[model samples]
Target: MKLSQSQSFVRFWAASTTSYFGTYITSLSLQVLIVANLQGGAADVGWMNASRWLPYVVLGLVAGVMIDRAQRKYVLVLTDLGRGILMALIGLTDLFGTLQMGWLMVMMMGFGILSIFHDAAYQSFVPQLVPKDMLTRANARLEQSAAVAESSGPALAGGLVAWVGAPFTVLVNAAAYGMSGAWMASIQHASKVEAPAGSVRTQVKEGLRWVYRHPYLRSLALNTHAWFFFHSMTGAVLVTFALVELGFNESKVGFALAAAGIGAVAGSFLSTMVGQRLGVGLAMTFSRILYVPALFLIAVAPSVDSFHSPVFPMFVVMSGQFLYGFAMGVEGPLEMGYRQTVTPLSLQGRMNATMRSINRSMIVIGAPLGGLIADTFGFRTSLTLAVAGLAFCAIWFWLSPMRHAKLDENQIEGV
Candidate 1:
């Protein structure tokens, strides 16, 4: 069935888009809160990033097993509700004047813990909603809506933050999550996965082997982990660089960052066509290659001091963000489709959790390290290192066995 015809998919899409919109708001607002309100710096941003993903490193594998054993739809609804309440509490805490850097990080840590279950269940739930043959198209539709949210969410966030302060902006995010949970709960379909007869350790090992032992999955996982580490470093410092070095206010930064969402929207429209024309693996490789020049543009962008008009610098930076967003949009759907199509229903949760756990774990380590480097050296230097590391990822995928793997090969070797 076409994704458009599936009522469950429509509800799922609504839930995802709503959550993504709110999440993007929090993404920018928290940074503004830390930098402008709390007077924190790059290292603080890194620690904040690290704290949010720390749970994935600590409990990701175990979360995978639990998700596989639980009902994914219920997991999705509960996690969304949990996140909504958490965001509301955060907003209230800040309103009361007790939301400090340390406390904020602690709240983010709690948020991350809930996210591990949400994300893992979310990915695994898709195959159950749609047929295998339509995976690419389904993911493309999802990415398109997400891209739209990405495009406008931050711009709105910037406005909201500037107009009402960053603390209150979080309440908007809380409402979005609450709505997302309601949308998710309205889906009519129900799903449950029976637990395998094994200990948790044994189940985790099985997932690890499935990911690391498969020829295509192994190469893809390694390269993706590398890409995430470097990509997250850039993420850790980009807000600071824009605000501090480029002299951009929250509104200007939001407008510039919104360009990425625009690019992603364009890319989502092109994803299935690109995957078909270039082949899934090569299309993914092309996206990775695009990251190099994109980051390079940002790394070499002139500071506001160097340019008489900030427009020139902002334009340059925005161009880089657009290219980066476009690349991600092109790759995201194809990669998710490829993984889900090949993995069995029973193993979907494990496969997603295993890969995502390690991927986010890279965020835990790389975000702080990047922040520290930016603090110790300079933003440009840290960004340059990220560029170099991403270049390695591009090459790794380009030369690895992954480039030759086709999406049509939907069967896992041992499955």
Candidate 2:
């Protein structure tokens, strides 16, 4: 299939890319900032991190309903502007030496709200910009842009924080958000789509009811909920495991993670091909199956015979990450395309949000559970348990309704 492009899509994508890079920078800088200045241990850091994500667990569905009722570009612009202002405030507060834990919590809460809006709007807007046949390619390109930003952006932020102060590094992120807002300001589409014309209460219920009533959505919701639940457990403990248990240096951890970008790029490029060649159902099935092997690598990693075996363990870690990322990349576009095909455009925001909320709730539950498990057992054991959960997710799908479902261009009933 031929690729399609638009100036609007270009403008929006550029904005998105800049904003994504900014988010990575902000995230890295925040961790550095807190660790360098805040007292207490990894638990404290985990609490702060968990708090930031907690809202997604709680408010994702509501955000989606509200956002879907409004113009997505406007929602996007507002979110960018709000975050830019908030980051600027953080920089200013820190510069004045008036930063407090309470203020930081407030800032994080505001940040989380904006994030909810931004993600919901972005997901709902993209399908409108391209044709149905090109959904996989479009999502792939977006994933590639995000991977590039994420893979290298943290190192850049880490360096900036190391040389300058962490607070000043936030300015870079603020500028990126400002640039995103400025570029997005000129978008001409005006988000022609509107909610079903009715009272606000009825419209909201319709969006939720549409998703819950659909068999495909029901299966997807359950599958993704379980998948993210386990994945978040791994995320909760990974950095600490790498740094504390393995005694790896920051640079090593960064380098190991950066190497996975190559896998992400390959997987992103291959996602559409896999879907076309294997059929969307089989492609998704394969991706889900790959996780069992990919995640188990860490559990089964052999201790190196030589201290000179730094490269070998690093290779093991990176290879595992690569496989995990690749599977995710391959699955994303196909899942997105299938979801878009099944739902009406008007329902996109709420449906995405509901699914996302379910997923995030699992993450919320899993991350703390992971931390507690690691605290009680060991990091390696926690990781092994997470792998067990991944295997469970595949089993959930294999025996459930998703195994038999095919991607249909319109709604089909009862499989």
Candidate 3:
């Protein structure tokens, strides 16, 4: 069946899309709040960002076990509600003038904890909602929503922050999460996976063993871990570089970042076609190779001091961001579908969690490391390092087992 005609899929899509919109808004607004309102610096931003991903590293294995043993839909709804309340409380603290950097870090940490479960359950739940054949299309549709959110959320947040304030902007995010929970609750389907009889540690070990034993998955996991590490390093200092070195106001920064979203939307539209034409493995390889040059373009963009007007440099940055986002868009669905197809239903949550944990663990290291590099050396130097690291990742993927595997072959047999 076409994804558009599936009612449960539609409901899931709506809830996910709504949450993504709010999440993107919070991503920018929170940073702006820290840097502009609270007098925090690059190091502070890095720590806060690291706090958000820390749960994935800390609780990922346990969460995977729990998710596999429970009803995923309830996990989804409850986590969304929990996140909504947390965000609301944070906004209230800001309203009463009691907000502090330490408090913000704590709340972001809470958000990350809930996010770990929500993300693992949500990824595992998708296969239950759609036919295996339609996984690519379904993933593409979901990514399109994300692309839309990414495209508009930052620009909206920039304007909102400029008009009202950063604290108040978070209230909108809270509302979105609340509504997302309600939408998820309205879905008629319930996850039907029977809880496997095993200790949590045993289940976790099985998941890890499966991934480590599979050559294709193992290579993909390693490549992605490096990819996220280098990417996070660049991202950790990107806002600081724009605001300080490029001399950009919040609105211009938002506009510059929005270019990526636009490119993502276009890539989402083309992903399925590209996958069909080039084969998923080759498509992923090419897109990742292209990402290296895009990062180079951003790293080499002229700073504000290099020119009287910042427009030219900003354009260069935006162009690079656009390409980066586009590559992610094209690769996201293909990669996700391949993983989903290969994994058994019983191990879905654990597989996703293990992979996601490895990917996010990089943020814990990269965020602060990036911030420290930028603080000690400079943004350009840090970015140059990121470029080199990402180039190595691309080369690694090119030489791995995944580069020669065909996505259409029998799932594990191809590996």
Q: Per-candidate TM vs. native?
A: 0.98, 0.89, 0.98
Candidate 1 vs. true structure, TM-score: 0.98
Note the residue pairs that clash in candidate 2: none
Off by over 4 Å in 3: 411-415
Q: Which stretches of candidate 1 lie over 4 Å from their true place?
A: 410-415
Answer with 1 or 3, whichever has the higher lDDT.
1
lDDT of 3 by residue, 1-415 (tens): 6888889999999999999999988888888888998888777888998998998888998898998998999999999999999889888888788989999989999999999999999999999999888998999999999998998988898888888888899999999999999999999996678887799999999999988888888888989999999999988888888888788888878887887888889988999999999888888998889888888988888877789888899889989889988998999988898889888889999999999988888998999899899989998999999999999989999999888655665755655
Which pairs clash inside model 3? none
Per-model CA lDDT versus the true structure:
0.91, 0.74, 0.89
lDDT of 2 by residue, 1-415 (tens): 3443576777777888888789877766665555565532344445555666678877887777887788888888888998899999987787688877667767877887788888888888887777666666777787777777766776677677767877898888988999899878877785667665676567657767877777767777778888988887777666566656665555565555555555666777798888878777778888888888887876555443444566777778778877887887788777887877677788888888877767777766787777777777878888899898889888777776666556554434333
Task: TM-score for candidate 3, please give it.
Answer: 0.98
The digit string of per-residue lDDT tens for model 1 on 121-215 reads 99999898988889899999889988998889889999999999888999999999999999999999867456666889999999999899988
Clashes of each: 0, 0, 0
RMSD of each: 1.3, 2.9, 1.2
